[model samples]
Target: MPMAAEEIEAMIRAAIPDAHVEITDLAGDGDHYAARVVSESFRGLPRPQQHRRVYDALGGRMGGVLHALQLTTATPDRGV
Candidate 1:
């Protein structure tokens, strides 16, 4: 089953308590999503590492129950 946007946001929030997560259903099909995650914890991390954290929050759902996520990460101070 494809994951819901709420589920994605909840999972990320659970992992990163202070993260501001915004999820958009890119295809309107519940499978392809675009997520923008902003958090203080990501301040010093590289882009790839920041994305890894969000992926980790998904608990291995990527490419399985959840697919095609276009992720963007940033710190609160450096909005993107």
Candidate 2:
């Protein structure tokens, strides 16, 4: 089954409590998504590491039930 946007946001929020998560369905198909996550927890992390954090929030659903996520992450102080 495909994952819902709210579910994705919830998962991220669960992992990064102070994160601001915005999820967009790129293709109007539950399989593709674009997520912009802003969080204080991302402050000192590099881009790849930040993405890794968001992925971890998803709990290994990235390539299985949820596919093709274009993710952009940033700290609250640094706009990306």
Instruction: Estimate the TM-score of every prediction.
Output: 0.96, 0.95
Candidate 1's TM-score: 0.96
Give one digit per residue, the lDDT tens place, for model 1 in 21-62: 999999999999999999999988999999999999999999
lDDT, candidate 2, residue 59? 98
lDDT, candidate 1, equals 0.93
**Displacement of the residue 75 alpha carbon in candidate 2, Å:** 0.8
**For residues 13-43, what per-residue lDDT tens digits would candidate 2 score against the true structure?**
9999999999999999899999999998888
The clash numbers for all candidates, in the given order, read: 0, 0
Clashing residue pairs in candidate 2 are none
Superposed Cα RMSD, model 1: 0.9
